[model samples]
Target: MELRVENLTVARGGVPVLEGLEFTLSPGQVLILRGPNGSGKTTLLRTLAGLQPPLTGSVSADPEQITYGAHADGLKATLSVEENLRFWASVHGLADIAPAVDGFNLRGLLERPSANLSAGQKRRLGLARLLVTGRPIWLLDEPTVSLDVASVTLFADAVRAHVAGGGSALIATHIDLGLKADTLDVGPYKADAHRPRTDGMRDAYADFDEAFS
Candidate 1:
């Protein structure tokens, strides 16, 4: 499957962050999004993942086929490492947790509660969840944050394996993850700050639409 974006305009709080953007992601390919801070990398990823609506244009991909990993590790602090994986596996209708465990080197911390793990361990767990989802497309935002040199290699291996298995990824990060991928710089697409401020009005209207729909 391929994901195509056509004349896409994405906004953050009603301010256009990327306008007239276009790209296509084919199976087994990776696209790296590069930009300075506040250049809308995260917003673009969120929009592609369908967490938010695009202000204009279209993102042509099945939402169910996409797995998004945000900057924050979405874990239950009280749950054991294995339990957390199990929960997500069940949610995704997956039967095997072995792959995820082995992929992230979590075999040693299976019984440890998420609250007690170090930042790198937690990040590994978060990335492992993507494997269990069985989704073909990965939308990762700064996935290498807080990872040590060795851990970064581990993550890079996982990404390589995923692509080898016919999966694709769209990653937003400042550092190189050692993957062969195309780069997209979002700097030129940033919206002008001098434009009118309609974010509040747009948000209020969105709330009204959600309430009535």
Candidate 2:
């Protein structure tokens, strides 16, 4: 699988955060995002994940084939670890979650509810959801938050295996997972707010809801 982003622009709070962005992520590869806080990393990821629309430009390849992970963990606190995996598995039409569970060393924590697990355990469980998703493209934002060094290593290994199996990832993170990958700094891509859009491409100011995500 290959993800090609071309001339993409995304916004937050009705203002462009990133503009004129272009990149390619090929199969068995990882692309690391580097930038200071509020540099639009999360906004870019959210837009790619279809949680929001771009203010301008297009996201090439396909957005539906993507899976997103973030710091929230996306877990149901009342649900047991195994139950949570099963829920996600059903959503993606996958029956086997063994690979995901083992990949993150969650065997011992499977029966425990997410509310009872430690922060690191929850993070591991969250990343494991990606494996069961069976999607080729992954959009991760600060995925290492709350994870200890060992857990981060485990997450890195999981990502490596995912890519090795013909998948690709675009990660918005600062941690060096020790993977062979390219890095892109989004700071320079910040949108020029003063520039006028004479091409009729709707600016984020066009709609209050659509551009605010």
Cα lDDT over the full model 2: 0.87
All-Cα superposition RMSD per candidate? 2.3, 2.6
Q: Where is model 1 more than 4 Å wrong at Cα?
A: 197-205, 208-213
Give the per-residue lDDT of model 1 (tens digit) for 1-213.
Answer: 778999887777777788889889999999999999888899899889987778778999999999999999999999999999999999999989998999889999999999999999999999999989999999999999988998889889989999999999999988888899999888877777566647664974497469757
Q: Considering summed lDDT, which 10 consecutive residues are worst modelled in model 1?
A: 196-205
User: What is the model-wide C-alpha lDDT for candidate 1?
Assistant: 0.89
Worst 10 residues of 2 by lDDT: 199-208
Candidate 1 local Cα displacement, residue 98, angstroms:
0.9
Clashing pairs in 1: none
lDDT by residue for model 2 over 145-212, one digit each (tens)?
98899889988998898888899999988878999999999988988777655433454345545555
Candidates' lDDT values, in order?
0.89, 0.87
TM-score for all models, in order of appearance:
0.93, 0.91
Which candidate has the highest TM-score of all? 1
